[model samples]
Target: MLPQELDGVTLLVDVPLAGLQAGDVGTIVAITRADDGRLRYTIEIERPEGGTADGQLIDLDASQFGLD
Candidate 1:
């Protein structure tokens, strides 16, 4: 079983983004659970200073990001 409420948890992204390389940080916005227990995470990417990145909200696999 996994914690269903993870909206505020920070995410350490390891995927590429708009004008940014992998390893960009993001925040978890939503999550969906598959019947098989795999998680698809909705992440909101942001610029280093502030504001939303062009990448914005995207779905990521569990292997693609880390919890912060």
Candidate 2:
């Protein structure tokens, strides 16, 4: 199923993500239907080591992620 807003998910594909892996967990911050009618998600990836909330936000297609 597609992830909803504020849902926790994991990356299923390798991206340009730093300090994170393909299976790294992230939170869905926002969702938007693209011009092609595909649902895109804005995810925030926190440091795996743990520290602050400082992390990178990335936009990915629903197929690139899996529900956590």
Clashes of each: 0, 0
Off by over 4 Å in 1: 1-20, 34-37, 50-55
Off by more than 4 A, model 2: 17-20, 50-54
Task: Give per-residue CA lDDT, model 2, range 1-68, as digits (tens).
Answer: 65788898888988853544588778999998889998889999865687543467888998888988
How many steric clashes does model 2 contain? 0
TM-score of 2: 0.79
lDDT by residue (22-58, candidate 1, tens digit) is 6667677788977778887787776667654644877
What TM-score does candidate 1 reach? Answer: 0.58
lDDT of 2: 0.80
In candidate 2, residue 5 scores what lDDT?
Answer: 89
